[model samples]
Target chain A: MTSLRHRIQAAAVAAALAIGALTACSGGGGGSANGPIEYWLWDSAQQPGYQKCADAFQQQNPGLKIHISQYGWDAYWSKLTAGFIADTAPDVFTDHLSKFAQYVDLKVLRPLDDLGPTSDISDGDYQQGLAELWKGQDGKRYGAPKDWDTIAIFYNNAALKAAGVDPSELQNLNWNPTDGGTFEKLVAHLTIDTKGRRGDEAGFDKAHVKTHGLASEGSGGGGWGQTQWSAFAGSAGWQATDKNPWGSRFNLDKPELQNTLSWYFGLVRKGYMPSYEEIGGANAVGTDKQIQSGTAALGLSGSWMISTFTKLTDAAGKKLDIGLAPTPIGPSGKRASMFNGLADSVTTLSKQPENAAKWVKFLSGAECQNIIGQSGVVFPARPAGTDLAIAYNKNERKLDVTPFTQQVKDKTTFLFPVTTNAADIAALMAPRFDAVYIGSSPISSLNKLNNQLNDLFKVAQ
Target chain B: MATATPTQQQASRRKAPTGYRDDTRLALLFILPALIGFAVFMIWPTLRGIYLSFTKFNLLTPPKFNGLDNYIRMVQDPVFWNALKVTLYYVVLNIGLQTVLALVIAVMMQRLTQKTWLRGIVLTPYLVSNVVAAMVFLWILDYQLGIGNTILAGLGLDRLPFLSSDTWVIPTIALINVWRHVGYTALLIFAGLQLIPETVYEAGKIDGASEVRMFRSITIPLLRPILSLVLIITVVGSFQVFDTVAIATRGGPVDSSRVLQFYIYDVAFGRFQFGYASAMSVALLAVLVVITFVQYRLTRAESSDLA
Candidate 1:
């Protein structure tokens, strides 16, 4: 019995030693001096364009290397935050307007105001309000504006023609909080039941929709559905906050916002849009996929998705006839879109902060922006780059994306809310919005949630 | 040529201190690497985490001592309470379903002890990565285009909202957890069954005892230790479920499925409230400790009674 006990203890000791060796093998030390400057981004579609810029930058500056990594949106943030905790964060990364505020507050970002290349960039080089959005509460810039995106309506021309509606009618669509105006009527007209009847007809089946008028993930302006209903809500005079970048008070409880949400989700009940259950599942089809398959006539999307929508084809290998139109005008007598931009930020923990800043400047400069514009993946922040992107889309993809540009030119764009507690605010409001989309709660429920969100803001302050 | 008595041998053993020293040194050499690693990776981190629970840390800045503020806030936080409730519900649902199902399978496998390949087939789900299994289940349970709803539609029944509705999301996630873990759990119980000597059962049979009666009186009492182990592990694992919830529902439909671990993750990484998250983690550890102690005592009392 004593010998048996000794054997068991030996076996356990062996197992523990093995686990220790494995753990020792897995962990790595901090960044080295000669290591490549690590860059991280979320959008896979824009990777190739940035890779081109990285290659050019390396050729120009010898002995310097850049390694770019891309991940999907949700995993990107989780991994990036974990990297920060482990002190293995990328030297430079693409920053979002919604997320940079927290990074600035955490003091993880290197201020760009004193950087040589960033200081060389003139205010007029970027589009209006693009450069200012990267500044923190200390009035120091933390990022270099790379590109901007605006919301627009992506329509399937074939589906529009099949519904007997003129394609031009979509261009002039207008909306109001009460009746939804002509835009809602157009949506009802585009909707078709399984029995081949339009949604406007009395005999239409709401349960069996063959083609939905609008393709949405059903969060209705909640959880970064900026392109989905923000345009409608913005045009209805519902700002996310009274002032962005540091707005302590959220404007979600405004009656105009409530009315907009009620009318927007009412489309789901009317069978003109997909229900939250249908389109909000983990494996639910994306908006672009629905448009390509003729399941949805129109998808409210950002200019960043233009290339993805254009490349979609039908089952017969025929190209999907995609058209871009400006968002519908709301009751405030003007169209509006959330003018959001992404910027490249250098981390303060970078071993080579100067090199990282140099990479960011090159990536955000007009030279690289123009190259990115030619790829037609997104509208570059520079005006000249935007012009090049519009021409490239027209000439190469045969798709016109001027409607997105028009939002910027006509001054119908609103800044995305830039609060320090953006994630907490979203956490408080997302479920409430989900309740609204699921028809389990009224739109007025947001008033209560808004109060809760404001309480969070108060705590944050 | 007479052999030494037991006491004489023990006295000689104690006198040879060199032999004892050699054995002690060998044992220390075997365990020193592991001890060093545990101190570095486990003990240090645990101590640091406990310290962080009393501070304010945002990962980028140095942690500042915040006294009991994080604990006070956690007590008042509605989301933390919601997460705790959801986690408890998940624990009950998953542990209740999985333990019963695993025991049944283990008993059946014991009857068919010759079929060793069945064990491998059953364990395949446990071998699969949790994230991969979650993604596969997400595809299968998709509300519109999933095989689950497709089959329901084909059977002339209304489609169930497996991943979307607040009412069904947690239960569905619990079912997925059961599917992935039941096989391994059954294997552990089967191993425990193998350890129970057959002679006792044979004696019961000779006494004209029925199989059901023998199983009830003998098998159950003998399986208590393994059953306790499985229950405690399942309870602890169910409380910390994050990957499946994250990949499937993202605690959606109004945070109905937001378990404690996922809430801690959202607070730590998403909101950058590391200190608060650490406090929540400490609270979770306390809850697990209490639960495990109760289980240990209950199982010990039952086994002692049987002995």
Candidate 2:
């Protein structure tokens, strides 16, 4: 029995060794003979549009194939970083412009200068500031313009009407760099819960109030970063970086940013927005959820959310009536929106660089931008694409997409500062943002965070 | 007859060789593979880590020797100090709670003369994966629509921020550790209980000693060896409580849940500072080794007294 036990153990060890060897040897690149190039994207919502693009591309080139995969934005970066470390990143991948500088620094992407017919897609056709965001520090293009999103105020028309406020009268509320404009009035006018208490009323208990006037799901970081607090930085005309024209050095400790976060969180404290405790779940209650449920009369989000929130109905099975407008002005008279744009990039490790470049160029082309515009997810990076999106939203979806186009054209759109260490700096700031939101840290502490960020970036240099 | 007698004498001489020599050869053959595995996997890796801890290696490019620069920076890093304080707090809280609960359960099991199946039921949770356990706990602690908070609200009390608050995060993580390991530690002590001779208990009872007295005098002393073993295991496990904190909080609410391992993960994977992360890991290993050695000496002295 003892000898048999020994034999069994030996056999098990041999089997494990064999399996490990096989896996180590076989699990790598170099499979299939010139098959489809792998393309990775983060948005499941955009998968159908990408599929459409793929079908068109495949028809154009028979031997060329496109293998597309999707991941949530958070997991996408982790996987991308791991793939880069392993020398096995996807041949073609999608990335946000704020994230471009870090990867460019790492030299993980191939410059587009070597790709064919680069002059065919003029930079002027796309949003100029956004198109310029993807240029590496070396002044070489690393991404082709895909789509752009800018922050906006999304309000429930039904809630406004019931509260006796004419939503139209509140259009283009103005403020200077010193005083917060009609933001305070609009929030009060639109806010009425089932108990019929206004936020401005004396008896209103901010802590116990059942419904809020507005709420925002703050996700901080480069790619997943949103305009919860950054908009205030833009309104104050703060820049996060200066090397690249689009690079941002978030003046996080600046009076403008502090004032913005303080007021934002104050809304929660004053019963104008949902409490951090109230909205806590596996996934936080977002602007979309707030507006769709009529729990919040107003929400701060972007145009892409219009498609998502427009489809959501209330518990009573009533469809929500939503409208989009520019973000409220800070003390500065300038209305501001945090601008974000995305670009398609080809990996330096791609087996088929030519095929990958063609796909990227095609996506950035006028024809594809027109299709994206019609789908109404985002304003096409191209000017012609924006017109198509507006027409499509008006004719097909029957909603006003013109507000987005108008906002961008009016120059309220502000781009985030890009830096070589933007990703690291954003990671550093995310926790601080949460602290400010929870009332755990003082608003002035943002300066300390900013100083630390400069120190980290200086060390990297 | 003379030739046959000579051949038989030669055979007897060959067969009479000592069995100890053959036994030693067999033992060496059986242990050689394990020895080789230990050298390659543990000793070599440990030495390499010690060397690499002094260098700056990001895994993308070749490593550069930076002398003690990484270590010097670590000394000044506030986050590192914070992580260390948090880790020590976690270890103390987790081990104290787990050891007490495990001892109680173990004594209860030893006292039981019926229902052997109860042991299986008690041990079931220990077999569950940390991921599944963390997910269950996460759902329970979720601020909205979670059962724990809902129950609190139903009882007319304000809901506690089980995970969202900075103060409660570490305690909640420690609770998870206690829940997962209490049963397994109990079983280890129970095994120690079984090893106590029936004669010793009979002798105590014969002298008209009470049940509690017998436990205090005989059972407690006999169980020290195994208890020390369990203590060491729990301490080491608590020191490296990474998975629960990772799955539960990802070191959020302003890094309240940040422990040494989580800090290392953030530096290595999150920010791509692999060299700094390696230095942190090397420091953690050194701390663990010193604690383990001290434990060995203490337990050895106590066990010698038992003998």
Candidate 3:
């Protein structure tokens, strides 16, 4: 019996070894000779649109293929960094302003200046400020502009009407640092308690809010709250940094920014908005779901969420009427929105650099941008493509997304901060912001966090 | 065959050279593959990690030797201190609750006459993936929309903040850990219980001893070894808790649930501070080793005392 057991165990070991060898040998390496361009992106919402562009690119270049891999926002960065360490990174990938600075410093990204038709792609061809956003510290372009997004107020028209507020009244709402101006009044008027009292009413129960007047994203504030509170802070004249890409000092400790945060969290206390516990909790749903379920009247969202809002339905199975309005003007007498964009970058490790560069060129060119615009997932970075997207949303979805486009045209947009060590800045600020949102710590806590962030920035310098 | 005297036969048995040598060689050959795997995967990585702890590595750039810099930084980091405290709190709560619950469940299961299938049903939680289990619990514990909150509201009680409050996050995580792992712990204890002879219980009854007395004298003494093993296992497992916290709390609401492992992950991946993370990991390893050694000594002393 012992001899038989030994023989069986030996046989099993041998079989496992053979299987492992076969599996390892069968695995193909990425970006090898004749291998397809390994492209990666984070936005699954825009994957189908890009897949269509890939199909066209394949037809135009006949033997070359582009394989697209999509990951969620957090997983994408983590896995991409791992891929870089393992020397198995994608040949072409979509890059973000927040991360591209670090990538440029690492020298893992190829400069687009010497690549295919990069010179032909002039500054005016794309949306204003987008082409500039992709430049590294060395004054070399690292990415080709793909799409841009700006913040806006997405309101439930039915909820607004129920509260006896006109949709156009939302368009002209202005905000101040102290009272929040007409915007605060509108939010309070729209807010309803379980006892059927408005937020502004004396008998309104703060403990049992049935529907919030406004919903921002979850309260884990990083360096900035782009779509959540940046519109308020930026309009109140709080710049994220002293300068663009390579700025060594962060402006988070500024009083204007702190006041905006205080007032935003104060809405939670008054039951005009959801608390951090409700919004950032494990069971929390997105802003779109909140509006669809009659839990929130307005959501401060980005233009990228236009399609998601358009598809929402109420409890009666009727499509909810979604309205878009510009962000409230603040004490500076101007409205502001965070203008962020995505770009396609070629990896320095690509086996076929020329091929990868050509693919990026096609992806960011006018033809693909028009195709992407028709999908209405986001506004293309090209001005012509932006108009096409506006037209598509109006004609097909019957939704007006002009508020987002108008931010770009009217120049009321502030660029999302581009800096090295952004990830460190975010990690240090998140918990502090969480404390402020939950009312455990005062807004002055940001002063200390800003100091830590500046210290990290100094290391980058 | 020839008959031999007792001494001669004993000598011949001891001198069975060919068969003994062959058996020893075959046994060594059988274990060679496993030994190779351990050296390549486990031992090599451990040595590499130790080396990395003394260097500055961002992964994109090649590592540069910066002796003790990473360790020095860890000593001064307030976040590191917070993480260590959170990790210890998690370990204590998780191990304490799970150990008591598991023992109780094992005793109950042993007493059960019918429902043999119930053992398998209880183990279903252990079979579910960690990520899947976390997601289910997240939904179940949601403040407004969760079933737990709904039940709380129905009972006319305020909704408990499971993942959103600093005070409750660690306990909530510990509860989830207990729920997921108690079945496995129970099974181990139950296996030990089965190994206890039925005749011992009969003897105890014959002596007119009470059930509690028999359990204390016979069962507890005999079950010492298994209990010690379970204690060590639980301690090690609880110290390394990460997945549930990552999915549920994300070390948020002011870093209340930021255990050491999650902190290491954030520093390495979020901040790209690989060398610093390695140093922190080494520190954690030292803690685990000391804890395991202390448990080992305690168990050995108990067993010796029984002997």
**TM-score, chain B, each candidate:** 0.91, 0.89, 0.91
Put down candidate 3 lDDT per residue, A43-141, tens digits, no spaces: 888999999999999999999999999988877887777667666678899999989988887788999988865645666788899999998888899
Writing each residue's lDDT as its tens digit, candidate 2 over B1-307 gives: 7799989997887787689568879999999998787556445555665666777866566778999998999999888998999999989988988888888888888886546888877788899899789879887987655799989989988777787677888898899878988889888888988888888989999999998999899888888777777776667667777878877777766767788888887777667666677788777876776676687577762452345
Q: Which candidate gets the maximum TM-score versus the true structure?
A: 3
Complex DockQ per candidate: 0.32, 0.20, 0.30
Clashing pairs in 1: none
Q: How far is A322's C-alpha from truth in model 3 (Å)? A: 0.5
Each model's lDDT comes to: 0.82, 0.72, 0.83
TM-score of decoy 3? 0.92
TM-score order of candidates, best first?
3, 1, 2
Error of 1 at A287 (Å): 1.4
Q: Which stretches of candidate 1 lie over 4 Å from their true place?
A: A1-32, A220-224, A282-284, B1-31, B207-210, B301-307
Query: How well is each residue in A20-68 modelled by candidate 2, as lDDT tens digits?
Result: 2222332223213376777888878778887888888889878888888
What's chain A's TM-score in each predicted model?
Answer: 0.92, 0.88, 0.91
List model 3 lDDT by residue over B1-307, tens digit each: 2556877888888878668878879999999998787566445555666777899888778889999999999999999999999999999999999988998888678755446798887678999878888889888888878899889989999888788888888999899989999999999998988888788889889999987787789877887777877887677768778889889988977889999888887887777777888888778877776776687677762452234
Q: Is the docking of candidate 3 incorrect, acceptable, medium or high quality?
A: acceptable
Which consecutive 10 residues in model 1 chain B have the weakest lDDT in total? Answer: B298-307
How much is the TM-score of the A chain of model 1? 0.92
